[model samples]
Target chain A: MDDSQLKRRFAEWEQEYSKRPARACETLSGVSLKPVYTPLDLPDADYLRDLGLPGQYPFTRGIHPDMYRGRLWTMRQFAGFGSARDTNARYKFLLGHGETGLSVAFDFPTLYGRDSDDARARGEVGKCGVAISSLDDMATLFEGIPLDKVSTSMTINGPAAVIWAFYIAAAELQGVKPEVLRGTIQNDILKEYIAQKSWLFPPEPSMRVITDIMRFASEQVPRWNTISISGYHIREAGSTAAQELAFTLKDGLTYVEAGIAAGLDVDGFAPRLSYFFNSHLDFFEEVAKFRAARRIWAREMRETFKAKDPRSWLLRFHTQTAGCSLTAQQPENNIARTGFQALAAVLGGTQSLHTNSMDETWALPTEKAVLIALRTQQLIAEETGAASVADPLGGSWYVEALTDELERQAREYFRKIDALGGMVRAIEHGFPQREIADASYRHQRAVEEGRRTVVGVNRYQLEGEKLEIPLLRIDPEVEKSQCERLSELRRRRDGARVEQVLTDLREACAGTDNVMPLVLDAARARATLGEICQAMKDVFGEYVEPPMF
Target chain B: MAKRLRILVAKPGLDGHDRGAKIVARGLRDAGFEVIYTGLHQTPEMIAEAALQEDVDAVGLSILSGAHMTLFPDVVRLLGEKGAGDILVFGGGIIPDEDKQTLEGLGVGRLFGPGTEIREIVEYLRDRFSDRVAEETGD
Candidate 1:
């Protein structure tokens, strides 16, 4: 049919549909969703310019031509709790159960650069994630797991470099060369300042440390991804989808600028820089956000930064299903939510994905719940056939329009951030924090006022719901044993050598020398995580955020 | 008239998850209470010291690192050592149901979990403070 006939048909359908009006709906980002979409919605879309062929420039379709046909996205589950030995068993269990890679989740103490026995650690030893204090704990955490055979992604930020030094030292003990090490350190501290709030040093020194890692990794650990610029934590901290994309990509750009300013070539380090995103409940909107992220990153790297290599232009990212979207009311329903969200990530061509377990809303997930979450990914990959093609929804008019709209919104944010000097300056001024707080408040108000329907929360309430699923309870004994082990380690290690290394580290932090080598030496000399962090803290001091309302 | 019911919002231990604590602080502030928020990574001793220095009537400790079993009792003990035992000590985080009773038994006033309404916390504080005032005044 031609334009006039299509318009007439739409008018007739609208008249009939209006008689039985459906409830209005909006996406998680507050974008209104239309009932029906057609060619008329995408007026400015150019087929070649906007949605290029897969593996080509402006890769809205995907970064690779064959996509999953070439190789399936890595099924990496984020798992860690208790001592290093305990987490190692879980790692072996996951790898035995068909997980493709490992993602380590450190506890609060480790994330804050505190040893298991520190006074501040108290009852937090291995509560949220595994506790890796010294190189010994790192060695135990990966006792039999071959470093060359599998890639690892560690989710620690403030003390990322120190923990990474422990991992490298552990690998060295296993006779693994730095060149063969494949993994990612979430050394993205800007996001820490913005959302996560796990920062150790202030922004300038933190950026210096991140640049040091990038330079060292690019030269020595060529296979390592230096930083996984994260939007996952930002979204989990209650930012909207557009805000997540914009703030994250801007953070990525800030890192790029930092690397360049530090005298590193863009292509040399940019290819290894990756991203982590959150796939929320809105299927179409999440897919569009992912697509727009790629397009925007590619344009900024190639056009703005004048990057020459295509590898530098690629926007490789890992995605995790949103944990904040899970409900404590009907915990079982979380499986279905995770399934749909994982499918969205897969369809959006994520390089890796971690699906949240059903019991996470209450405590750490049980082994049974983790298996279900893993099986959800397997079913998506093997049974659902969603992985059979690249960008299955690429040509849909609604998706394209949404993708364009998201790109437009992100560019607006970029302009605003640029006007505020940059992301660091914007964060220092509490721009992103205020934006997220406002959005969070607005969403909570919507839920409270019944304007939004959260299943099992406001509507379809179940009376006197009892949580029947088994919750994973970390034994308080774990903390006691970990503290004992740390004391034993301190007693065994060479105190004079540790002191010498720490003094050297403190000097390096005070000077302009790259501190990664000193950190590596300290790790090898049996310097505890807290000891190394304390040395730097003595030099760089700690970061205290301004009051953000 | 009772000095606006001063409260110290402290995040004890190493947990960096402070969204709930910040929200509650804001809630108390909007409810006309004087709120002093101690940022992340406060030890039990530091928290007690802050309570003494700020002269807060109550101390609200927010911990999500599953360290409530150790941190809560330590805070109470420290406050007692510092001669501030009469100050109200409340808590919140992802504490399980069974642990809630244990924490309360350890002298914690109340423990709020996720999805708790902000007004519920405000009301609980109001009622507790008013009761303490009545007892002191022999009403």
Candidate 2:
């Protein structure tokens, strides 16, 4: 039918649907939805310019032309708890079970640039994630794992450079060169201040550290992704999907600007800048968010930044299912929730994926729970033919409309961020933080008012429910042993050389020098992660968050 | 009218997951409670000090770093040592059920886990303080 006839039919359907009691029609991000979409929705959409084929300019469809038909996504379960030895064993287990990549989760002290021996680190050492305090711990963590063969992604923020140097030095001990080492460091400090709140220094020094890593990696560790600009933590901090998309992209643009300002060429450093997104509950909205992310990044890189290299335009990302969507009640239900969210990510064309375990809300996943989460991804990749083609739902009217709508919403956000002088200043002003807080509050109210139905929470009543899932508990002895090892290393390592390298690092932080080499030197000199971070913190100073609700 | 229940919401340790803490604080504020939030990275001493300084009747400690075993009990102990034992101490995070009971035994009021409604917390606080509120107003 033509546009007029299609409009008339849609109106008639709306009238009939309105006669019955219709629930609130909107995505989880509060984007309004229609009962059905038609050809009229794509009235002005030009397929050639807007969405060329996959691997072409403006990668709205997918990054790779063949997508999963050529290769399956890298399957990584983000596992780390207790000591490095504890996590190394888990990594071997995952690899033996056909896992493709490795991702490390660090403890709070390690993430915040504090030592295991610091007073603030007490009771928190090796509690939430693996405690890697020194080069010895990094070497132990990767002892059996081959550095050259496997890819690693470390989910660290404030002390990314120190941890990354440790990894490189550990690889050197393995006789592996930095040139062949492959992986990503979650070095996005903007997200730290805005959402994750693991920031070490003020925004100025953080951006400088990020650019230094980018320039160094582009030269030496050519295969390594220096920064995985993340929106996962932003979403976990309770921002809506559109907010997640907008704020994350805006952050990416700001990084590009910083790199350029630091006297680095855009195309040289931009290709190594990867992205990380959260696969939220809203299925089509999430899929749309991913597509829109690629499209926006491509346009901004090619048109705005004038990046000549096509590699710089592709928005390669790793996706994790939303952690906030998991329920502590009827924990088994989370397995299903994760499965659907993972499917949404794959359908949206993720390069890598991590499926959250069922018992995460209670504690870190037990071996059994983590294995089930892995198998959920395995089933999606093998049992389902969802990845048989590139962008399987590419031509769907509803999905395309959603994709365009998300792009429009994100561009509006871009304009807003630009007006605020960029993401760094916006974060300093607590703009994104306030936005996330407001969104989270609205979401909580929706659940309480019965507008949002979380199964086994507000909707289903399971009387006298008991949590039967086993939880992984970090041994308190782990903390005692880790601290002991740290003290022993302090006694054993070349204390004089460590102090000299740290002083050099401190000077580099004060000056306009690329601090990565000094960081690597400090790593080789057996300087602890805390010492190096403190050396810089001594100069750059720490960020004190102004209280806001 | 009787004074609104004063409660202090705190983030103890390096756990930066404040989505719940902020929401709970805002929810308590909306429910007619005067709420004070310690933004992030607070020690047990700082939290206890803030509770005393704010003169809050109750303190809510939010942690997700699995240090609840160490930090939760420490907060209670510090409050007691500070002669603020009458101040109610509760928490929310990934605390296991057994640990939750142990914490309650150590004098923490009603530890809410994930998926807890703000209304449940508001109601619990109202019920716990209703008698004191009555005593305040001579009801």
Candidate 3:
């Protein structure tokens, strides 16, 4: 471990590898990976000072002392698509398959707060995920599933409040008290404008709505994660590994500032705040990214925000296998890719994980496909024994080096964003957009030029490969079924109550009052998603992007 | 003049994932074609109207949800009813191969899936447009 011996070993390994030649030495984020590392590299590194034991300051190893030993990570298989009944069945199936938690993926119409029968929602009902237009649909979606037992994470952004209102109402109908209802609402609309492009209101108003939910949830749903600041979609949108880490942290910081500005203590709501990360193909990079993310968030939380509570400093996250990486060509190969990605998630110390199905590239995952995906995680947990050890790669020289490098690169991005006046300002200036576009372009060029091999894509030219895997096909009647349901709900609901709730929602939008309570009231009254959003639109107005270079 | 090979890049539904659409739009533009990107959440009527107003040579509808069967044919039928039948209507998404064939038979030109290169869409559009032009000129 001495400096001289470390140098000798590094040189010796360099000589040995020089003869063999490296397959690759570059991180996915383009950081150059040195062949070896030793004590010399960490001369200034204080192991006790830098990486204290888990659950301590600068908690790089993990948030908890005994991570998986205390309790295994939540296996939340993301489901929803088709009629509420169909999606409900899928949820039950996943739960039966040993899934510990539920992550609901809403269809496009529901995501945008549209009813299935809306002109804009024509062919989209139950397409990508379930169509929950009202509390009726939400109730149907969670029909038999006990609300208090299983935690749900709804992947909704623009209309997060409205959709969450429906969820709260549905839970209330099930006799689950607001305090007992556990789940997360991906109410991070800032990221929607930044990457996902799913914004209903402009950023300023959107932030206000999000802050209100944070304010409310801190008191009501104490166990619920108010906003899961997601880097998964950012990574899926073609960001580099470093970009994902940096942008995600930057976003997390923005939310903290927003919460503070909203007259809430930093530690009050910060403990419940969570993150969602993407587990991409590069195994080491993903692990390093996760480690660096924890280190940066913990340090910033304590030093910058002065968060007193240890729980406030912890960066708990949910990890999903990279969907963009799944290829329709050689569909079965996605299984291996998903397995490795899931393994990276486990090694990275994700609090929860969702492994993407092989046929996800074509449509919503078939049951068989989803079973394989879930089994991928089960195998990693039981057979691989990866869960037995906490941060198994923590002491490895290469992993530590990569982690340090990732932190440095991400800090650089953070500094750049800070210079540009934080995340919102940077988004306004289109800095993140341009960076991702350039990164996406570079990655595509690399694939085309054969610098990076995507198996069946850039390499392994399988001519006329017949896809053997069975792809999930949504019953075309699902759309009709959804439309019929929407039609019936409209006819059955009391027209007078719907109008009254819509008026109240519009009035709240026009005033400084918290609209989420009004949203919940509307959901309880069976006001559809489209109606509630339309009420808000009458006051807040719609979004139109300005053309720029 | 052979009419500037106009194409409409329309996001037909609520799926806001537009990276692929934007990339394809930029690709078509770079390939010497005029692409009218109708941003996000356009109804079938709006799409048909935009195509007619832009006088596009083709309409490229992008829908990621499994709603192409209902949405795609709606646009196709609306285009026909609106007297915009000559325009080639093509699209892409997470569509099953069987549905792709079905949509193509209903006058959709081509269905592009994930990993479908923009270069391929560009080449096909060019060849098909040129052939149409040639047939019109009796060449």
1 against 2, candidate with superior lDDT? 2
Candidate 3 residues lying further than 4 Å off, grouped into runs, are A8-24, A546-549, B1-5, B131-139
| lDDT tens per residue, model 3, A1-549 | 467876887788778888985666787768776766666656667786667777676878888889888888999999987788988998999899899999998888888877888877777777788888889989999999999998999999989999988889999999999998889999887778667777788778888888889888987888889999999988887899999999989999999999898889999999989999999999999998998899999999999999999899999999999999999888889999999999999998999999999998887888999999999999998899999978898877778877888888899999999999989889888888778867876776577566877888767859987768776666778777777877888888888998998898888888888888899989988888998988887888776554221
Docking tier of model 3: it is medium
Chain A accuracy as TM-score for every candidate: 0.98, 0.99, 0.97
C-alpha lDDT of all candidate models, in order: 0.91, 0.93, 0.86
As for candidate 2, its clashing pairs are none
Worst 10 residues of 1 chain A by lDDT: A441-450
Q: Decide which is better by DockQ, 2 or 3.
A: 2
Q: Give, for candidate 3 chain B, the lowest lDDT window spanning 10 residues.
A: B130-139
Reference-based TM-score of each model: 0.95, 0.99, 0.94
For model 1 the local lDDT of residue A189 reads 96
| TM-score of the B chain in each candidate versus the native B chain | 0.93, 0.97, 0.92
Pairs that collide, model 3: A80-A130, A81-A129, A81-A130
Cα RMSD (angstroms) for every candidate in the order listed: 2.3, 1.1, 2.5
Weakest 10 consecutive residues of candidate 2 chain A by summed lDDT: A1-10
